[model samples]
Target: MSRNTTTHDEFSDRTILVTGSSRGIGAATAKELAERGGDVVVNYRTSEDRAEAVVDSITDAGGEAIAVQADVRDPDAVDELVATAESAFGTIDVLVNNANISFSRTPFLEHPWDEFRDKLVGEIRAAYNCTQAVTPGMLEHEYGRIVYVSSEATRTVRPGFSSHVVAKSALNGLARSVATELASEGVVANVISPGPVRTEASADVLEQFEDQLIAETPMGDLAEPRDVARTVALFASDDASFVTGTRTPVNGGLLVE
Candidate 1:
């Protein structure tokens, strides 16, 4: 699990748009796709410098990439983002919905109703906006891949994540629906639910629960961002042409069912 070692060139002529890809799993997936010869659009709501850095890294590695800023929750902005990517790369062949708000670790009883509604609406809206914007291009080409970044928490419940899990569960359902409706058109949709992954945002949580997490995980280790990214690359590649309406977990064998 080193970074950027994937040799799949299926995306050589494809363009991919990854939301919230300035850092974390999104960044890793963007780089992995670029390394595999896909032109990448790195989307971020803020963190312009970080997003630009990701673009620079891809270009330095001889891969094509550009950073675009758009709030995925806004339909108009998402349309603009897709338009920009299409303008730069001709057409977008893959859409990775990875942007999400961090969950607040509060007791279920103490969680505000408005906050929960906001979280659910925001997450679902972003996915809807991106999916709607990218489907027409995919339909025209008769080839597309939609990958939603979900969470294992939906299956393996944890305290203080009720709203987050609910939203992700809905997203999984959305992906499945997209798969059913678009499969005949040569477009595939799938979900990747990662376990506890080591990233900048999860550093503190990992540090606090490293022992507990490893003990629960049969693999005895946490997943790196690249671990999740590799799976995404597979789904986005032509190799997974028949693999649609599936949810693959990348959670180190934790909560196996």
Candidate 2:
């Protein structure tokens, strides 16, 4: 993707931290926020090259960015990540919890309990750690945006995604609770649940249901990472100050309410 120059300025002089931003939706979000005038910290667990590429893209576009390495699942690492961002750009005004593990589909009955437990713990714990690390800084500044990238599987009730759905559902609940507790303090929390985004992580699953998904979706196409990133940008901007505790679906009408 080419560098986007659309400027919103809502994030001017602000700083953003996007976990797992080395690729896909997270990468797209990091670029989008940077384009809109936010200095960004690109956090990646294992993709240093990709993370630096993201930073280079933003900087090449006259935006400020830095690549930081952190495994979001580790509390100590998360704390260090937040500290690194603070040291680089003062404070993180937006936190996007987009890092997650990709696992092969398995029937709930046949799936190993250990695998299920690991998936849930990994997904939920990462978000918990990142949130805990950033909240204190946000509270001190009296301004913040917390966005959790979720999935439609939580509500669509699809098979073969038992562990994924449960973990995302828990993330939604966590966002809501955080929103309620932080709304009065100028910090807003929300979830952006995208249905079947086209990414390496979802390629296998999308291949299995491409025809059905396209037919069911009113828009007749799967979402690109940029599609979800746009919604995330909205939530991360100052324009969404009053919007909290809500899950905005970027599913192209696949499961509209």
lDDT of 1 by residue, 66-119 (tens): 999999999999999999999999778999999987668778999999889888
Give the per-residue Cα lDDT of candidate 2 at 250. Answer: 92
lDDT of 2: 0.91
Question: How would you encode candidate 2's per-residue C-alpha lDDT over 1-257 as one tens digit per residue?
Answer: 34254568788899899999999999999998999899999999999999999999999999999999999999999999999999999888899999987665799999998899888989999999999999898999999999999998888987788999988999999999999999999999999999988998778777888899999989888889988888999999878999999999998898889
Q: Which stretches of candidate 2 lie over 4 Å from their true place?
A: 1-6
TM-score of decoy 1: 0.97
Which lDDT value does model 1 have at 182? 99
RMSD after CA superposition, every candidate: 1.4, 2.1
TM per candidate comes to 0.97, 0.96
Which model scores highest in TM-score? 1
